[model samples]
Target: MDTLKQQMEYAHNITLENCRVAKPIRFTETSSAYGGGAEGLSDGFAAGFLWLDKLGLAAKYQVTHLFRQSFFGGRYALVDMQLNPNPDLFLSVLYKRLVEGPVFQVTSIDIPAQLRLYAHCVRNAYYRTSWSTEVVRFGGDKQTLAIMHLFHYRVSY
Candidate 1:
């Protein structure tokens, strides 16, 4: 995970450094992945997990925008060619609901590599204050033992 984070950060820095003249550096055709063949990435929850990880990583890197390729076509498409929604689509929606405010710092101990965690908070825009913590812990392989903690804080503003 650290290596992946470093590689993404390096690429982002290089783009910014090289595109100084442009008002904004742009990256195009970002997809979760491809080459899963006609079956569309994976048969079930595996594909959804991959996408959920990618979505979290993208947010961590501060990507201006991302395109989930083949929303309704191609082998890695989120929806079937017949317009049926897949598991990945539902995962995408869940991520969408998660990231309402800016990502914040989280500290944990002894977290297994297979289990990944992400966090954000709900902010009161009218007063510009954060009131709640929303942490999402959803990633694991066959060998991983997963335990999730949902923390809610009632802050007196």
Candidate 2:
């Protein structure tokens, strides 16, 4: 996890230096560490996604594979050969449904390294008024806890 963070930071720095205008930094392909089952993979993926979103380092990311096929192997596939959804697939769906763009800065002091918090605009489809969403992640051995809080308000133009 530390190594992944360092790589992301390096990439962010390079992007800032080379581009006159801000360009979205994307992770084309990524997956959890090896030797884990569906649950572990889901936890790791969720943690990584939350970390990236919290830091605003990645505008987008793609998981390694969607289908468990021989060509790409079945290790990190989101679905199995029988087309059953993996645990991470649910996480992906929830993320898409609940989170919107324009990541907000999160300030914290004396927080544990395994705990992460991120804020974003709530998906407009879910509510008529403006709303903010906060996602909290606590990672532990072989498990992760994620909580989402929504704040709603009206904005007059």
Cα deviation of 134 in candidate 1 (Å)? 8.0
**Cα displacement (Å) at residue 125, model 1:** 11
How far residue 18's Cα lies from its native spot in candidate 1, in Å, is 7.9
Candidate 2 — which residues are off by over 4 angstroms? 34-73, 128-157
> Candidate 2: lDDT of 12?
69
Which ranges in model 1 have alpha carbons more than 4 Å from their true place? Answer: 1-4, 13-32, 36-43, 122-157
Error of 2 at 34 (Å): 4.1
TM-score of each: 0.63, 0.62
lDDT of each: 0.57, 0.49
Over the full model, what C-alpha lDDT does candidate 2 score relative to the true structure?
0.49
Best by lDDT: 1
